[model samples]
Target: MSEKIEPTAAIEGAAPGAALSPAAQRALEEAAARRKAATAAPAPAEKGGPSGPEPTRYGDWERKGRAVDF
Candidate 1:
């Protein structure tokens, strides 16, 4: 009968490097910069301003003339 072999024996090629390639590194850096900029930028004011009346919870229901009263 054949015996079980070590898992590593199944692998036949050299291991891949842990480091990112130059172009990949640049792309990763750019993505990180864009993410940082997006989060750092001030959020745009809501359409009617910060103090505008709160939006209805069920805008679609209101449009359909449906209401649930407790």
Candidate 2:
């Protein structure tokens, strides 16, 4: 059996052209600055190989330079 779905209520301060309080504006600016700074920072260089032994196939394991099977 199908049931009727009710419409969701609108969120406060989420409408287009809505004005935000000074505190809320400051918080949004700070969050945006932090995001920009995080993205501007350089990422660490990746190592050459896997950090630990990983399963390659069913019942098989592979490490830096060796493979084991059972």
Candidate 3:
């Protein structure tokens, strides 16, 4: 079956930042600054593997046959 497609209303030729209120603009700026700082910061160094074998709680898994009889 074919479906009808509808056009969506989109605002063009507008500065996206112009839609933000003063508080929202300030928050956006703060978030951008935090993101920039995070990108600029050095990443943590990787560590070696564990010294000993780790324990697990897993058990043997089996699938039982159906209970129906002929």
Candidate 4:
């Protein structure tokens, strides 16, 4: 099988003083926004799961690793 590439392969491909193109920058921003939006939704629970009261505040659930109420 072919061997893995070195980490510096991409750095070697670009010109010494080159900067990211506008198209490339825009693509990166779009990808980041999509990722954020996708993860912003609450996770779905299975049937007959622990259904309970809504959280009072975000920081309350977030303080614990799981978004669950104690």
Looking at candidate 1, the ten consecutive residues that score lowest on lDDT are: 5-14
lDDT of 4 by residue, 1-70 (tens): 2543232213323444456565554565677678788989888776854347544444456423566556
**Comparison by lDDT, 2 against 3, better one:** 2
For model 3, which pairs clash? Answer: none
**CA-lDDT, candidates in order:** 0.48, 0.57, 0.48, 0.53
lDDT of 2 by residue, 10-44 (tens): 32333445555555555666776788899999998
Q: What is the C-alpha local distance difference test score of candidate 4?
A: 0.53
Off by over 4 Å in 4: 1-18, 48-70
**Candidate 1 per-residue C-alpha lDDT over 1-70 given as tens digits, one digit per residue, 9 for 90 to 100:** 2543222311213134434444555565677678889989998776733254443654423323655353
Which one wins by TM-score: 3 or 4? 3
C-alpha TM-scores of all predictions = 0.46, 0.46, 0.42, 0.39
Pairing residues by index, what is the TM-score of model 4?
0.39
Deviation in angstroms for 8 in model 3? 25
**Arrange candidates by lDDT, highest first: which order?**
2, 4, 1, 3
Cα TM-score of candidate 2:
0.46
Worst 10 residues of 4 by lDDT: 4-13
- How many clashing pairs per prediction, in order? 0, 0, 0, 0
